[model samples]
Target: MAWVALIIAGLVETVYAAALERSATFTRLWPTLVFLAGVSVSMLGLAIAVRTIPIGTAYAVWVGIGAVGTAIYGIAVLDEPATAARLGCLLLIIAGVAGLKLLH
Candidate 1:
């Protein structure tokens, strides 16, 4: 389904985001390759989903998912700050994404 593809694309966005960080501006060979692969897969999924889903709604959801997931991963695994404000903001993003889905 288009929704499934969109979700997978969003998740891949997170992986690519993390990979981008690890890539060190493409200085590292493996991380750079991973980043490239992630980007390809993520974009392909997004393109597929947009064939069925509205671009505005689909893009917003994809970005929301990626942003939230990447932020959570950064806080939990990358030693980034896990402040109350950050958590609250992340929850707000989640709520927004849910609202978009419900309205759709």
Candidate 2:
């Protein structure tokens, strides 16, 4: 359950990051609201998960998932860079996430 919460938090963080990237003007009220809501939820979920998971491991996994997921979403939907080098970095992020999970 903690793992599930942690993963969801990470994914939500990714979504929030993407939303924030397009929210420079602050005129898009809905996306901005969604982003704020997502951030609040993600932090709450991480706080709950931290009760059981090691702080270092949980933080690493959270950041790894957010970075990789946001990058992938950017490339696929926003047509951001999906070059081989970028993909390699994504793979490395996955490896780090997996390493942290294996500690469980």
Each model's number of backbone clashes? 0, 0
Residue range 48-80, candidate 1, lDDT tens digits: 999999998899999999999999889988999
| Alpha carbon lDDT of each predicted model | 0.95, 0.90
Error of 1 at 62 (Å): 0.4
lDDT of 2 at 14: 92
Runs with alpha carbons beyond 4 Å of true place in candidate 2: none
**Candidate 1 positional error at 13, Å:** 0.4
Question: Candidate 2: worst 10 consecutive residues by lDDT?
Answer: 21-30
Output the lDDT of residue 32, model 1. Answer: 94
lDDT of 2 by residue, 1-104 (tens): 98999999999999899888777766788779888998999998899889999989988988988998899899988999789999998999899899889977
- lDDT value for model 1: 0.95
Error of 1 at 85 (Å): 0.5
10 residues in a row with least lDDT, candidate 1: 95-104
